[model samples]
Every structure is written in C-alpha cells, then in structure tokens.
Target chain A: MNHDAYPDSYIRGILNSVKTIAMVGISPNTSRPSYFVFKYLLGRGYRMIPVNPGQAGKDILGQAFYAKLSDIPEPIDMVDIFRASEHVMPIVQEALTLKPKPQVIWMQLTIRDDAAALLAEQAGIKVVMNRCPKIEYGRLSTEISWIGVNSRTLSSKRAQILGKGVQRMGLGTPKD
Target chain B: MADAERVPGFATLAIHAGAKPDPTTGARITPIYQTASFVFDDVDHAASLFGLQAFGNIYTRIGNPTCAVLEERVAALEGGTAGLAVASGHAAQVVVMHALMTPGDEFVASKKLYGGSINQFNHSYKNFGWNVVWADPDDIASFEKAMTPKTKAIFIESIANPGGVITDIEAVSKIARKAGVPLIVDNTLATPYLCKPFDYGANIVVHSLTKFLGGHGNSIGGMIVDGGNFNWTRKGQYPMLSEPRPEYSGIVLAETFGNFAFAIACRVLGLRDLGPALSPFNAFLIINGIETLPLRMQRHSDNALAVSEWLSKRPEVLWVSYPGLAGDKYNALAKKYVPKGCGAVFTFGLKGGHEAGVKLVSNVKLFSHLANIGDTRSLIIHPASTTHKQLSDAQKVQAGAGPDVVRLSIGLEDKDDIIADLEEGLTAA
Candidate 1:
C-alpha cells in the first residue's frame, strides 16, 4: 500500500472541506451497493447531490436529483461515479468544464479510464483510483478490528503475537 | 515457450484439452491427489522446490495437480496464457490488484459492476491502502479522464452485474492502451462464449465462478486469467510483474514465464501469501459448468430478450431494462460489444413502487427469490428492500434501486414458465 499516494493525514484534513458530493448513479432502492455507500457518506453528514436522469425531478433521501453533474446549483466538491467506465469520461469532462472544477474525481469499483485521470491530474486535481472513500474513512481512523482471538489486546505482546479475535475484525461498527 | 496443444472451440477444450491419461496410472480424469505435501527426489530436489528453482507442489494450499487442470482448462476457455483459481471472487480481485497497485496507487474501473466488488474495492481494500477510481465503460473518454500518475490499471466487466449492461470493450481498451496501462476486464457475466475481453484488448481477466460458471449454484470459486500480452516492463508502470522478487530467488516473472507470468504471480505470490486457494471439489463443478457454457449462454440471452420484450408490453409494468431491447439506452453499446447475445440478467419495474415490486417477487413461483444471477434457474430479487436495505433513501435512488425495480435472472427453464410466473407477479402488482 502506497501511503505517499494518499496521505491519510491530508485526507483527514480535507474531510470537513467537502460539503457536497454529486453522486452520478444514485439509486432509490435501499439494497444496491451504491445505496449503502451513499448512506454511509450521508451519515457522515456530507450533502449528496444525486444525479440520475431517470429521477431528475424527484427528491431522494431529502436530496434532489439533477440530470448531470453540471446541472447542480451548488459547487460539487467531488464527482462520485456510480455509473459504468464508458459513462465516466463525459462526467469527468463535464466536471473539468465546471467553472470550479471538483477537487476530486472518485470512480467506483471496476470503473477506470486513463484520459480522464490525466485530465484531472493536469488540472491539478487529486485522483483516487479503484478505492472507495467510505472504506478509507473507516480503516485509517476507525477502530477496524483485526482477526483471531487467542484473546489479545491492542499493542500488547499477546495482541502482536496472536492478533485479536474474529469478532474484532470490522466489528460492523462505524469507527469514523 | 513450453509446448501445449491449442484446441479450438470451447466445449472441445473444456472436456479434452488440458488433461491427458495419467503418465503413472493411465487414469482418464485428472485425479485429485488428497495429500499435504509431495515427496522429493532428494534433499537437492527439496531445496530446489523450496528455492523456487522448479514448479512443484510443496503444500495443498499453494498448488495441487487436480486444481492445475481447472486452471489450464479455464485458461483455454478464456483464451489466455494461464489461469489461477482462488477461494472466491473477492480473493481473485485482491490478488490481481497486488500485481498492479502499490498501496494508494489507483486503478480505473467500471461503475456498473457486481455489488460485492463495489463493497470490496470501496470498503475492504481501503485498509490495504488501494483506491478505486470509477469510470464509465460505455464512454472511453471517461476512463481516459480518470487516469493519473498513480493509476495502474483500467477495470470493467464484459457485462456488468445485475443490470446486464454491455461495455464497449474495444473503445475502453483503446483508452487503456493510450494511457499505457493494462486493461482488466471481469468476464464473469459474459463468460467466454458471449464475449472474450482479451480479443478486445483486455490484458487480464477475472471471474466469479460461483455464478454462471458453476451453473448448479453449488460452489463458490473464482479465476484470474492473463493474456500474457501486456508488457509490464514499461517505465515505472508494474514493477511487481517486471521486477525480481526477493522471495523467489530474485528472478523476474516476466523474464522467465513471459506472458503467463502474471497468472503465475497471482498464483505463487498473491494466492500463496493470502491462502485463498480454491477447493478441488468446486473446481470440478466449474468444469462441469463450462461444458455447457456455450449452450447455456445462448438460451440465457434468447430467454432474456424474450422476457424483456414481454415486460415492456405488460400494462402493469412501468419500465423494462434490458440491453437487447431496441429502445433501451444501452442497446447500441450491446450490439457493438455483445453481438452474439446480451446476458440473462435484467431489471424491470412494477407500476406501483416498493409494494408492487415486493408483491411481484413474492408471487412468482418459477423465479427463485434469491440475490444471485447467472443461474440455470430463473431468479428474482427486489433490491430496494433486500440488497439496498442498508442504504438511506438517498443512496438507494442513486443505485438504480427504486421502489418499483425488480431484477430477474432468466434461467434455462422454458421461457414461457418464467414469463408466466412473472406475468402473475406483475398482475398481482
């Protein structure tokens, strides 16, 4: 893992800086993966501007859906992608064309493109590839549990030797 | 390169390509040698195996003769250099990623993908220091825009999970090449018959064999296939593949194994350390599934198209989503990428919303009310209530899981029975 590429401290510093995120592929159904990711982010208190052409006029989770990233009235701190890879460049290009370019272009899992990343990099934007912000926020600062019990505590010799217990891992608890 | 017979056609290879009569016992099938370790020729031979001077099994977790057949057969089916089997799809992704990403380094990927992958790339991997950058597979430019100095690979599925949207492989591959990054395509949904991402320029392929590949839904497994085409030696790109490993006598993978080296790296390095080896029993099941893959895929597509058209006309239905449908937004993309057939999985909506969608899922008899897709049996699920239940109201809407949405995984059974079941469900709605 390259900590230099994503400075955890720097990411923590900017946590409060982002007020709104334009989620391009927001879903209304609660079971979708994006739904939980969006839920987690929203629970963290970030305002998400949903972008789905299908439900353009409808409001979801108390947020209004805009047709595109550019259509949002407020400045979007990040253009969180939930669409396919082929659908991203246009959004990224649109993000670039914004009067105030989004500080981050976060693509979802299994989505990737080179031209868009270069464009963002050239424009002096920070790039996070193949990673989810929700997970990062949890792991770096959250009390993510390690695996195994031999019943050891953190930083103790037993903890270092046997690790911890299975229940500790993840704990399903929101550390952040 | 070592000589191996290259058989043409999928079924022919699935049954006969990889294995030969046992040189020792004359057994026709690849026998599962249930053992912990292999006997060495001598101390020098033992030292050689330990030092990585030769390829031989030291333990069941690292390598097995029977599992090798599954890897070889899958590699043949996928038309790649070699293949590696793992415990699950998540494990495969984790191992493949270690080959390209060096913590915090990024990989561009498709947003329309399996739900589990979304969680894996987004949540589980963050602790390891990897990051996911989303891009639209339909638009090559979107992928190009997401690249950065830290970008290692571009990832997408041949046919996305749940939605069954086809990706423009050639277009996405073009962007990946221009960026000088390897294109990684998850061919789980498309399998090899419907689409071969390697032919379209994908350097690496991954699959969750638990789905369509294991048709019976009895086992969980995954595979990583390498095209052996990408040159990892490019400047500062993938030193993991190109550079020498301190663990293995400091020999470079690319220098020795060449194209198939990536597969070897995944098996020897990633799988070795992670201990996510696939069970021989599951590998056998996958082989069984591959035998009928070509035939099953054909019906799966045909039945899906028929069902989509049926859903579009129902008075009780709101909207039908299938790539094969003429007016569907992704139809053109499907035609270009999946000319043979679009997949069996698709989503449609009931006139009423959450209640109606739930009613339809419950009323259906033939359609199994389950979360999985790519099954031989017809399956259905209401994501808003089940899959997306964890998300807040806002998140569900963004994920295309509105109250009315109902997903179907059309099966090998008579399309009529499947439709009849859905027909009753829609009427109930």
Candidate 2:
C-alpha cells in the first residue's frame, strides 16, 4: 500500500474492520498524546489494549497493559505504534511473530519508517504511516470536522448512532 | 487502485459538515436536543464524563447535540480546529477573553468595530477587570504601540462594521505573533464565505450568528472558532489551557487537546462557568441558515456592490465607504482579503448630515429601518441615531459612524428595486 496518501475509503475500511487495537508506547500520564488517543478510541467503543513495558502490570482507563505485542493474550486486529520511528522496526517484527498476526500496522503521527512498512506489506499485513488513528476516526466519522478541522471526506448520508447517544460512521460500507 | 482523494468544497461542507440524518428517528434534519441534561449509562460513565476523561454531552449549558452541529459546521467552514457556540456575539467575546485574560489583563482592539462591541469592551468588560486599549486598524503601527506586558490578546474585525473597511489581518497577525498573543478577528460581517480569518493568520475567529449566518436575522447566536494555530502552552502565558484545572482532575487542556485546546478551554472554563449557552432551537436555525450561506452571501455581496456604485454617483451621497468600489480607501485590502465582493453592509455619507441620515432611514420603503444587517430584506440604520448613539462625537467618527454616515445592509433584493428604494430615500433626504 502506498504511504504517501491513503484514500478516505481505505482509512475508513481499516477503522471499521478493526475491533481490537493494541496501542504500543501509550503513556500513563493523562496529558500525553498517546493517553488521550487511547482514551478517545476507548470512548468510541473500540476494545483498546494498551502496550507499555513501563506500566505493564497496571491498567490504563481500566484496560490491561502488555509489555509487548507477543505477550497480549487476545488477538489484536491492529497494532497502533505511538513510539518513535527508530523503535517501530522491532515492534513490527515482533507483531509478525504473533500466532495470529495482526492484520494492520499503524504508525502514529510523525513516526514513519518505510523499511518497516515494506516488511509489513511483504507479510501481507496492511501498513499505515505518519497518521493518528484518533484523528482519522474523527475525520471519517465527521466528528472532528464539527469543531472546524478539515475532514477531507464528505458524505450526505446520515450518521449512524449506536446504542446510547453516541454517533459513529462505519468505513467498510457506504450505508454507515 | 489508489483513487485520488477529493476534498469537499465549501458548499458541500456548509450543508453536510456537522449534520447527519437522525440516528434513531432517521430525521433528515438535525433535531433540537432540547433537554437540559443527558443521561449517563452507569456510574463509571458518569464519572468518566465528569472527570473529562470522555467526550459526551453532560449539560446543555456546555454542549448540546444541536449546538454541536452548529459549532462544527461553522468551524468546518472557517477551516479551524474546533468551535464553541454561545448565546450571542458578545458572549463569544466574553468567553474568549475569560480564557485568555485574568482580572487586570488587557487586550488591544481596533477602534473600527461594531458600535455595540465598542460599548461592551469599554464598559461591560471593565466590570470583569479586563482592560481594552484601542488601536486604529488603518495604522498598523498602532497595534504594536498598544501592546504591553499585560496584553493577553489582540482583537480586530475581518471587515469593520457599518463602514465596510477591510482590516489588514496578516500585518496585525504578525504584530500579535511578535507580542506572543493570539489575534482574534470578528468575522461577523464578512463571514467565512467571503473572508476566512484563519487563512489570514488570525488565531481565533468570532461571529454574531444573528446576522448572515442565520441569514434571516431571526435568531441571535455567536461562535468562537479556534484556528488551532497558537501555542497556548508557550511560556505558560495562558494558564487556562496550560495549567491543570482543579475541576477536571488536573487535566492540562493544551497538552491533551493539542491544536483545539483554545476552543475546549472556552467551552469548559468560560462557557461552563459564565453561563451563556446557545439554545438548541437557535442552533438548528443557524444550521439551516448556514446550509445556504454560500448562496446567500454571494447574492448579498453582488447586490451591495451594484448599490454602492450607484450610490457613489448620486448627488445626495457625499461619499460611499464601500471597499468594493474601485477608488475606496480600503479597496486594496478588500481585494486581498475578501476577493469575493465587499459583503452587504457599507456606510455612505449624506450631504445633509445627521438629520438627513435619519430621514433617509425613515423614508426607505423596502429597506427595514433597523439596527441589524445581513437580512434577506435590505436594512438601513443611521448609527449616530441608533447603534452608535451612546458613543461621543470623536468616537462616532473614529468608528465610522459619523453624523453624515448612513449604513446600509444591502439585502438579496433585486438591484433595481434596492436602488429605487435607496433613490427614494435619498430624494426624501
């Protein structure tokens, strides 16, 4: 997959299909960007499993933290890397070693490594670089645009509201 | 195949940015979520919301589903990070200042502003211990001269009210940058359709939705769009965003919210406490008005330019202060900023002075003799006798509301009909 620019549909497809996301390098500090993203995705009803070696035994927003991707007991649909580019190759390599390999490897904003992305693509795992899943989710769902950030995607279709008052848009199908 | 991405155009976002068909009822329009409060799923849900760990509506006073749509739509149009909707344009100003200023802090503002705003800054804001230092928008150096250590923000209008003067936003924004202060632009007259302040380097954009954005002049509302460009955390100057809030479990808004921290600060700290919330019904009306914003604003601008050209040639008119006119003083700035015509509102001087100004307003048949602008029907007001009545003689002239000045908010009426009505008013004057 080309990392230059991902189409709205492509990003949306990954967002909707992924039920469980393992966010690596998430911090315990509430003010950190990773913590905020983890919290936001959790609020969006995604099953978030935080991966931080420093806080492996503790929980973040009530979700268990794992020391590494291989240590995660449950299957992860996607591995969201919040660490720097230098640390990404090892994480992607470790993700490849899992019994049921993660379907996608997503690098957070400003963390892009073409070599790791190529390796993941060679392994048949979809790769996204230099993007924030929280921002992408908000943009595709038209949630971020509400506050004025330009969400390049535009649709006249009504937003889908799940149980409770939460509103969400699905990427896999246009009907959502 | 990797398909090329197509970003939505202005009109598309105006209609669909913050809206979707109702989730439960499948309502085609955004419904008015009129309730004062929202229900929580459980104890943890309530705790998470109260702790600012979640993004969900808690009280109508802070956020509502309807107002959220309006906020989002306006924010999207302005290309800002986020927006916060409030009760009125004045409320937006107050909320923004509340976030940026402590008691005894000062903000430098342009003298060429809506008269009511001048009064608000001069009088009402004083009670809050916020000081306003006036500067001439025409003199770029005055903005720099007015700044002090106490200066927390710099405010100006994208287009001055009544006079239709265009501000040199980029120049002022540079001064604001030098002072390490956020520049707030009142985009009420120009609207995002004509002049997006964010694009011109304004850190924040405020609007009175009662005017063009609502289009009909029916409901009164306000909005504060955060450009998300300012570093609120730098030097810890703005404690409201940089400091940990005692209310929200010591959450540093600037660090957590990132680009949109200013908007979040205004909503949670300013609006939450100050208590100036926009009604859901008003939000719905503004949203509807915005759907046709691009269309209405274009027609409004076209009509105003034609009317201004005609008025400039009339014997009854001493001078027309429309930037759309070729030889006008701010014409160059207007071309640079609002290349889409000079907007609907402009002031023209009457040869007969203040009495004639009042007479023209009274004699107009089609134009409504009201203080408001940006209506579908042409509206006229002699600021010296109406909106700017409270200001002194010097202030009146400085604000472009001199005794001879007659402000016209040219509407969507046919150019001939609007011209005819103005001619009759001019004849009577």
Candidate 3:
C-alpha cells in the first residue's frame, strides 16, 4: 500500500487491533521522543515491552525492559521501531524471527525503509512508516486539532457517540 | 526544511515553528484571535472540549490562538514540549509553583534573583502556604542543604537580574534530579538567545516576556516552558499530575498528556482558576518582538560589555559587578552558560555612596530612569532608593541593592552614545 494513500480506517484499524507493543531503541531519558511515545502508549492501555541493549534489565514506566525482542516472553501485537532507517532492516528481520511475530511493523517519526517495509508486507505483516503513534493517537482522538495540528481526516461528520464520560484517548476494541 | 528528521536552526524555529499563514484569510503574520469564545461545531464538540477528550480554544481566559502561537514559538525555541503564556512574570511564577506545590510544600530558590522576585517569594508565596527556602547560588552546596522532605522544586535565574551573575545550572540541576524534583530556571534576563536552560538539564523554564523577550518592552507578558524532562508520574510525589484531579472529573493529567502535562496542568488548573491571561493584543506585540530577539540581544550584550568596561575604569566607580567582565567572580560561569553574551543588566557601586547613586540616576539624559529593563533605550535605576526601597539596609545588600549601587540596563544604542550618556551621569555624581 502507498503509505500516504492508506485510508484513515486502515490506520485506525491497526491502532485498535494492537494490544501489546515492543518498542525498540527506547530511551530512559525523559527528553527523548522514544520515552514520551513509550509512556503515552502505556497510559493509553497498551502493554509495552521496551527493548534496548544499554538499558536492559531496567524498568521504564513500571515495565521491565529486555535487551531485544527475542527476550520478551509474551506475544507482541506490534513492533514499534524508534531507530534510524538504516537500523530498521535488522530490527524487522529480528521481529520476523520472534516466537509469535508482530502483526504490524510501525516506524517512528522520520524513519522510513521501503525495503524493510516491503519485507514486512511480504511476511504477512502490516507496515506504517515515518509516523508517530503518539501524534496519531492524539490526532484521531481530536486532541491535537484544537492546537491547530492537521489530523488529515477532515469531515463535517461529528463522532456518533456523545454525552458519555469521554475516554482520555479515542481508542476502542478492535473489530475483526 | 520540509524533512521532519532535520532539526531546524534556532533562528528558523524562532520565526516559523508555531506560525503559519492564516488558513482563513491568508494573512502572513499570526493575526490576533481577539474574540472571547470560539463557536463550537455542536454540543458534542463543546462537551468533548470541556471533557478534555478534545483540545481547542474554549474561552479567551484559558486559551487564545495568538497567545498559543507565542506559547508554541517560545517552547520550540527553548526546546520544550509545550508552553503557556500568562499576564506577567509574577503570574507565571505563581502558576508554575501552583502546579508543583500544594499547601505546606516548600521550594528551594536562589537568593541571587531579581529584587521583585525576592519580594514575591519571601512575602507573596508565603500567603499561598508555599514556603520558599532561600539558598545562596554563589555556594552550590547551599542549594543541597536547603532541600528537605517538603521541597517540591528548585528555582534559579539563568543569569541573575540586576547583578548579571550566571548560575551553574548543570550543578543545580543534578541536585534537583537527585532530590526527584523539577529544576525551574527563570530565563528572563538571559533570554533563549543567550542561554537555553533546557540544554543544561532544566525541567521547566520561565521567562518574563516583558523584558528581553518582548525586546522593545512594549508588552508585559511571561511564559512557562515544559522541558519534558521530569518524571512527574514517579511515586505520586506530584499528586497534581499522577493522581486524579478533582476539578477535571478525576482525570489524571500526566496519564493523558504525557510529557507536556505540566504545561497543560498550569493552563487547565492554575491559569483557569487564577485568571491571569495575557491579552491577545499583547501576545501579538510580544510575538512581533520575538522575531527580532537574535539581533537585539547581540547588540544589547555588546553595548552592556562596553559600558561595564567604561564604568570599571571610572575613578568615582567603586566596583562594576558584570559577569561579562573577565575579572568578575561570575565571568567563568558566564562563559560556560551564556557564551553568546552575559545579557545587558548589571550593577555598579559609586565611590561617593548613596548620594552619588541618586545623582547618577538624576543626571543621565539618554538613559530612562525607570524600573523596567531590556528596553530599546537605556535605563538607570537606584534600586535602594526605588525598587528595593522597602527593604532594610542589610536586606537591600542581601538582595544586591546596596546604597551605593546603581543598576544600568544598557540599551541597543551606539557604544559611544551610551558611554557619553553614562559619562554625564558620572560627571554629575
């Protein structure tokens, strides 16, 4: 799929389906973008398995981190790559070797590897490139539009659900 | 520049980060959204906005588009996650402290700060049940000793006002990190052009936009930038972020907003309740002023250094206490923190004492005898006789306002003209 041509539904579908994520290249430093994305997804109810060789055996946001995706005992629904484009191919190969491979491969902001993405797609995994899950979550939830960030799915239609105590995030159960 | 991976340079970010041509009118400049409230799409839109599920302008008192631009620009320039603009410098202080401390909590503050800030911390904050524990910035060990179980934050000025003393921010930030509290740096005197506190490990940066930021001194405004470097979620130390807030229907801000939660909290709770909103008109003025900060700061620093050197040579001048001067105690700190320049405000002592200080303030023709600093025009003030007049002699000295002291906020005039102006003051004294 052309990454830009992928419909909002396609993007939203992946977000709703993903339950557990293994974030590679996650940093302990709060100022780093990886730290924010990790904490944000965790707060949004996704179980995060942080994989960083340097910070292995440490805890981030109360979750014990592993040196690599292979060390995570539980099945990962998605693999979020925070490393550079050059590093994504090896990370994707590593993800493909996992016991229960991730259903989706999501690259972080500024990371795009067509070859790695093609490999993931050929292996029956979905691919998202050069996008931030934290920003996407906020965009879909209409949290960022107020501050003038374009969410790209402009429509006159308001959300059908109303008057209930709003969920902090606009995520929901995956529709199979 | 279109690539997201390439970080924009400082001048580019300062000019373009939070601003875009008007999507509605195609105005090149960020136009002031001067209305009181925005029209919601429907009841559900309003509800989601109020419910915190959506973010948008609800009322002017809480947020405005023009002020949001100013907030975002400064945040980008400071390398922070987010920023909130408020009415005045003191208002920014109250909001930031309110977000961090509850009643009975204490914060450690550098004693070498602006005279007005000293008054605000020593007197006004006491009424809010937020205690200020003073620590001498000259002695880095004093900050560590001032910390107690009640300490919620560490506060200092990047380059302290009136005296131009550059703080050892990295050293103080380490202490704050060890204590598990945010380090708040006042970057009013040392604007982002001179120093970026976040680069040295500050968790939050507060600025008096009334000064250097609003360079022409046309607007009275302030900002609070969330450095996104503090773990407000750890151990429930910051109940305001980690715990469910009673006002927002038990919603936890940190859980919802991630790194920018402190900035959001200050806007949602602190400014919303305190009601110290920066007017949209002032926001426009300040934003315009910020577009020229890089140019003005360089000139201001150059002029101040030359003026300080001239003052140092005067036989009637007892001492010049400018960090830019090599022989000064804070010179080394200035080189480390404010390498671009040591800012334009500094104090000097007259050999003839209080009478001469008064004489200098009275005689300067080019310098405006005003309380404000960071104006385009030069300003001279005898703090002991004016700004710090209420304090006792000993208190004045402690606040860097001795009877012989005369503060000069060197302006962006030709160096010879500024020297000539000061020359008249010295001759009269």
Candidate 4:
C-alpha cells in the first residue's frame, strides 16, 4: 500500500463493513482527542471497546476496558491504534495472533509506521495510516460539512435520514 | 488505485455544495426548518447532543438545517475549512471579535473601509473595551507599526468599499504571521467569485452576504470562514481554543475539532450567548441567489469596467477611482489579486464638488438612489451626504469618500444603458 493516500472507496468500504472497533491507547480523561473519537463513534452506533492499560478493569462510556487487544472477548472488526509510531509494531504483531484476524488496522492521526503496515498487509489484513476514523466517518457521511467543514466529497444524492430525523450516509457497501 | 477522483467545479459547488433533496417529502429544494427546537430520541441521546459528543440540531439559535446548507455552500466556494452564518456583516464581526478579543484587547484595521464599519469600530466597539488601531492599506508598513502585544487580529478589505482599492493581502498577511495573529479579510465587495482571501494567506474570510454572494439585495446575512491554517494552540495565544471549557466537560475545542476549531468556537461560545442568528427564510433566499453567482458577478464586473471607462473620459468627472482601469494606482495589485475583474462598486469625483454629487444621485433615472450595493439594478449613493456623513472631512478623504466622491454600484444592465443613464446624471449635475 502507498500509505500516502487511501482512496475514498477504500476507506468507505472498511468503515461500512466494520461494526465493532477496539481503540487502543484511549485515555480516561474526556478532554483527550481519543476519548472524543471513542464517544463519537459510539454515538454513531459502533461498538467501541477501549483497550488502555492504565484504565484497565474500568468502564468508559459504559464499555469495559481491557489491558490488551487479546483480552477482548468478542471479535473486533477493526483495531484503531492511537499510540505513537514507536509502539505500533508490537500491537500489529499481537493483532496477527488472533484466531479470526481483524479486517482492518487503522492508525490515528499522526501515528504511522510503514513497517507495521507492511506486516499487517502480509497477513491479509487491510492497513491505514496517519488517519483518524472519526474524521473520516464524518467526512464520508457529510456530517462535518453541516457546520461548514470541508468534507472534500460532493454528491447530488440526497442523504438518507435515519431514525429521529438524523442524516447518515454509507460507504458504497451494498448492505449499508 | 481507481481512476483519479474528479472534484466538482466552482459552479457545481455553488449550486449543490450544501443542498440535497428533502429526505421526508423528497422536495427538490431544501425546506425551511421553521421550528425552535428538535425532539430528542431519548434521555441518553439528548445528553449526547448537549455534550457535543454528537452532531445534530438541538436549537434554531445555534444551528438550523436550512442555514447549514448555506454555510456549507459558502465554505465550499471560499475553499475554507468551515463557515458560520450570522444575522448581518456587522454581527459576524461582533461574533468573531467575541471569540478572539477579551476586555482591553485591540485589533488593527485598514483606514480605507466602509463608513459604517469605521463608525462601528470607533464608537460601538469601545464600549466592549476592544480598541481599534487604524492602519493604511496604501502604506503596508503602517500595519507593522500598528501592531502591539494587545493585537489579536488584523482586519482588511480585499477590495475596499467606495474606493475600489486593491489591498496587498499577501504583504499584510506576512506581517500578521510575524506578529503571531490571524488576518481577517472582509471580502464583501470581491466575493469568492473575484478573490479567495485564503489563497493570499488570510486566516479568516468574512462577508456581508447581503451583497454579491446573495447577488440580489432582498436578504441580509453574513459569514465567517475559517482558513484552518492558523495554529490556535501556538504559545497559548488564544485561550478560547487552547484552554479547557467547563460548559461541556472541559474539552479543548482546538484539540477536539482540529482544523475547524475556530468555526466551532464562534458557534458554541459566541453565537450561543450573543444571540444573533440568521433566519432560515433569508438563508433560503441567499442560497437561491448564489446559484447564479458566477454569471451575475461576470456581468456586474463587465458593466462596471465599461462605465468606469466612460466616466474617465467625461469632462464632468474630475477623477475616477477604479482599479480595473489602466493607469490607476492600484491596477497592478488588482490584476494580480482579482484578475477576473475589479468588481462592480467604484467611486468617481464630480467637477462641481459635493453639491454636484448630490444632484447626480437625485437625477439618475436607471440607477436607484439607495445605500446598498450588489443588486441587479444599478445603485447610486453620494457618500459625503449619506453614508459618510458621520465622518469628519479628513476622515472622509482618508476613506476615499471625499466631499466630491459619488459611488456607483453598476448592475447587470446593458453596458450602453448604464452609460446613458450616467451621462444624463452628469449632465443634470
């Protein structure tokens, strides 16, 4: 993978297919960016599992936190890495050991390691780097653009309003 | 990878950037969401909405679906990260300053500006303890001299009102960068069709949509666009973005919202408390006006240039101040910045002085003698007797609104008709 840019279709496909995500390096503090992302995704109907060693055995937004990815009891469709570049290799290595490997490994904004991405790609797992899933979801769905943020995507198609008059758009997945 | 993604052009964005078919009725036009509040899904959903953890409409005062489309369209046109719509151009200025300025803080602004803005900055803003420091757009060094530790922002107009002076946006932007402040450009006259201030290093772009963006003069509106290039977190200069807030559980806006933090600040903090919101009906009208912005602006510019050229050769006109004409002082900067055209508004001095200006306005047949601009009908105003009446003689001259100056906002009328009407007005004067 070039890792320089991921096409919108490639990102949208992963987002629509993944129902549950495990966010590593999430902080207990609400002021942190990671916590904001976690809360946002949870509100968007994603099953968010926080994996933070410091906050292990506690709950964040009503979701249990585990010390590591292996401790997640259920299958994870994606593993969202929020740590620094130096710590990504060990996490990717650990992800390769899961019985049914996660479909995608997404690194948060400013966190990228080509070596780890290559390792994940070799194991048939999709890898994205230096991007935030929260921002991507907002961009793809036309949510952030409501308040004047540039989503860089334009469509004439009317956004489908879900329950309660809330508008949500899907990646090009047929089931979505 | 798949074929390279195709981005929409300017005209396409102006027509469809923030709009979609109505989801419930499937109406082709965006419906006016005429309600005060929205019903929540439940207690938890309501909590999430109030906490800023979710993005949805809660109240009309903060956000409305109809206004949101207009906001998105303008932001797209300006190539900005985000935009916020407010009541009027002056209201937009107030909201922006509310976010950036504290008591006793100051901002540097160009001396060449709309007479009403000068009045607002000089008298009204002082009540808030926000001092206005004047700088000359003609003298770029005056901007550097006006800077102080108290300066939070630098304000200028891309193409000044009445004078049609083309400001050195890039030069002033460099000074602003060196001073560690954001540069705010009032792009009311230039509009996004003529110039994108962000392209010239402006950190923020503001507009009185009552003008060109709305194209027609039927509606009143304003907008603030975030360029998303300035670092609000640098050295903790902007506490509104850097510091934690107690209102929504202490989340820092810059950290959470990233590039569009300034827009969020203006909304969640400023607009929420100050209470100057753009109505949905006006937003709908503005959105319709913007659909034909490119065509209207081109005609306005073409007609304006033709009229300026005609007036320059007339014996009754002493001087014409339009940057689009050859041999004008600001023509080079105009060509560099707004190559498309110098916009529709410009001023000309009468040989008979202030009384002649008053006579010309009173006698004009095709041109409507009014205080507004950017209308489909040609509008005329004598600044000395009307708009600039509040300013002193020296101040009026400094703002390019001298006693003899008569301003014309050329419209989409035919070039010959506009000139014929101007000839009659000058002959009567």
List DockQ for all candidates.
Answer: 0.01, 0.38, 0.08, 0.49
Q: Residue-wise lDDT of candidate 2 within B1-429, one digit each (tens)?
A: 113365568998899877767656878788989999988778767775676555667889988878988888888899987889999999999999999998999999998888789889999998999999999998999999999999999999998887787899999999999999999999999999999988878999999999999999889999999998998887568999988888787788887676788998998899999999999999999999999999999999999999999998998889988999998999999889999888999988988998898888889899999879888989988889987788899978877889999888989988999999988887872
Candidate 2's residue-wise lDDT over A29-97, tens digit each? 885678878987887778999999999899988998899999999999999999999999999999999
Alpha-carbon deviation at B53 in model 4, angstroms: 0.7
Candidate 1 C-alpha error for residue B244, in Å = 2.1
Higher-scoring candidate on TM-score, 2 or 3: 2
Model 4 misplaced stretches (Cα beyond 4 Å): A1-4, A163-176, B1-4
Candidate structures ordered by TM-score, highest first: 4, 2, 3, 1
For candidate 1, the per-residue lDDT at A117 reads: 83
In terms of DockQ, which candidate is stronger, 1 or 2?
2
Cα lDDT over the full model 2: 0.86
List clashing residue pairs in candidate 4.
A148-B82
> Which candidate has the top score in DockQ?
4
Model 3 residue pairs with clashes:
none
What's each prediction's TM-score? Answer: 0.69, 0.91, 0.78, 0.95
Better of 2 and 3 by lDDT: 2
TM-score for chain B of all predictions: 0.95, 0.97, 0.98, 0.97
Model number 4 iRMSD: 3.5
Tens-place lDDT per residue, model 4, B325-358, is 9999999999899999999999999889988998
In CAPRI terms, model 4 is classed as acceptable
**lDDT for A130 (candidate 4):** 86
